[model samples]
Target: MNILTAMSSRLTVPFLDLKSQYRQHQAAFDGAMGAVIAEAAFAGGPWVERFEAEFAAYCGTTYAVGVANGTVALWMVLLAMGIGPGDEVITVPSSFIATAEAISFCGAKPVFVDIQEADCNMDPGLLKAAISSRTKAIIPVHLFGHPANMEAILAIAQEHGLPVVEDAAQAHGARYDGKMAGSMGLAGCFSFHPVKNLGAFGEAGAVITNDGELAQKLQRLRDHGQFEKYQHEVIGWNGRMDGLQAAVLSTKLPFLEERNAQRRQRAGWYFEQLGGIPDLVLPASLPEVEHAWHQFPVRIPCRDAVFAAMQGAGIGCSIHYPVPIHRQKAYHFLGLPEGSFPVAERCSREFLSLPIFPELTEEQVRTVTRVLKLWITRNHRVKNIAFSGKLAV
Candidate 1:
């Protein structure tokens, strides 16, 4: 067999393996389901309430409202905070579109900001310049599960009397200055999609806050605006979390810390192996914050070539975001040009998310690193590629 044929027939590594996780925890999951079924509370019942309390405590907050999904959690937070038409919500441009979509859903315009190249998080220095009389809220995303520079952002928000809603969608157990991710700001929103560190079986999200009034407002908004059942006092939407999802989350929450530790260990392995590979840029991990390696995303000059090479070698890799939010077609109405956020746009072209999860064995990490090194060594011609600004994987 020739080198080409041998390279064509290699072991396949998945981006994540939820099936194995489910099978490993099948008994515990079955017991959780049995209890949920026996209670017969399928939608926003005791099961949901129980999980809400547990999650709120986990986040070090006094209240948590379980919503249908992360996007709705953002919308509900905006609505509960009375952010709507004619108001502007400031956030970085590289986060999931849901960050902006939630603000748009509440009739608010999302103001874009450029991110620091090192962390891919909102640059706190740019906050003041972007603030105006119309600016009402600041939503800083903990991109890639690394906490945002909250101290700086909070200072700016406080000076301007603006509320902050942390988009902790990718950061479940992340921390900044010894504070948990969802415990900061007026409120912090989380997503429990299947890929998240503490994911539920299906879509699930929560809004955690120390402010009781905001928490109560969220509770009412996630329901039908009824402070009491069948007593609607204001407009609301059906954003309730299903009981089964809550059960799944309850079973999963107890394991978050342990799983997060495993992810961190895996990150260390990646750094140890991939360090100093030419043309590769590793994102920063602030010494003061705890990074919850949700996705091991790296920036390389020719990310498309690196990603394609990994795929062809039967290794699973992905692009965290092929297009920054400001450049997306849906957000074109914001009237922002391609170069509005240059750093974010450049990152969109070069960002690559490698396979990462608590379940990834050390051997898998080695294989991924080995493949990356081999590809980078074999193809040292990225400087001459003349690539497009966006490389969709």
Candidate 2:
């Protein structure tokens, strides 16, 4: 059958169907919440402690400190490490604003470096140039659930005697050369926002590390820097993770591996169906790493037109980011020009995130690809006709 004929029966594919995920395991969620309510453990208590231990073990780390959100997790880690004013943290500009916000909130400057086109991550080769005498740390984000080049980044950080704080918010089950996403850095920060691979029902985050001292300091930082009740040791904020979010996370933790596998399988299906379309760029994964496939972002010309077409076809699509952080109004004080980070800038303009979730079926994927292919064909035909008209004139 022709492509259009095959897709005549349309399916409405959501960008993320959280309701389906919840319905699949409603009983466990209800039970977990009930236990917390019965014990009156609403704040940071046994439930939070239980989840911290479980998550730490899962990440192969000695300590994990739960916090209010992923941005707080990153902020608390920097605060614990004493990254204050005049200090600069090197990171790429192609991540969520939270990554840079965490550093800026800690009274430090966030230095931006361009990303590598292949992985859309921090280019380790550009690391040295961005580092200055004030550079104290590095925060490499595992953007879109693909782990960054941790080995090279770590080597560079070690040479400079700076610590590495991995922004692993999107990469729960991702791995690089057999090492878990959050385990290779000095400290790894994660977000359990509702849309993440391993999400809590509400806002939650955590920091995992092997250093016992850093862990203790982080624990204190999240709880108003208190060693004991009513005794404040250092200036801190109310960053503690609530027991309800912790309970939700604990209940969902066991199924994360299976869900991640399902996402990977769906990603494979996209690769099979969307390969070799002219002028389309597919995301690339290094052979040494296992991606968690948090967001399947593809690059194509006339992205806005295609995005609108996809939406009209009832296929939910979105943009990972339409503006690079360096060009954001909040960062204008940094004085970065339009082309400061070309790779990230180009990616911002062209990247389109298709529907990708654990519950997305193979048939839904086929439908999305079919609609995308039809748009490409139409776009090319328009360009060809315009070119031919110009030649005849």
Best by lDDT: 2
| Model 2, span 1-393: residue lDDT tens | 333333434658889988887798899999999999999999899999999999999999999999999999999999999999999999889999999999999899999989999899999999999999999999999999999999899999999999999999999989999888999989999999999999988999999999999999999998988979999999888999999999999999999999999999999999999999998999979998899999999998778877866776678999989999999999999999999999999999999999899889999999899889877776686764532111111
Off by over 4 Å in 1: 1-5, 381-393
lDDT of 2 at 44: 98
Runs in model 2 with CA error above 4 Å? 1-9, 384-393
Candidate 1 per-residue C-alpha lDDT over 1-393 given as tens digits, one digit per residue, 9 for 90 to 100: 322124537657799888877888899999998888998888899999999999988888999999999999999999999999999999989999999999999999999889997688999988899999999999999999999999999999999999999999999999999999978899999999989998989999999999999988988988999868899988899999999999999998988999999999999999998898778887789998999999999888778867876777778998979999988999988799988899999999999999889889999889888877866665554445553322222
Distance (Å) between predicted and true CA of 360, model 2?
A: 0.4
Measured with C-alpha atoms, the lDDT of residue 372 in candidate 2 is 90
TM-score of 1: 0.96
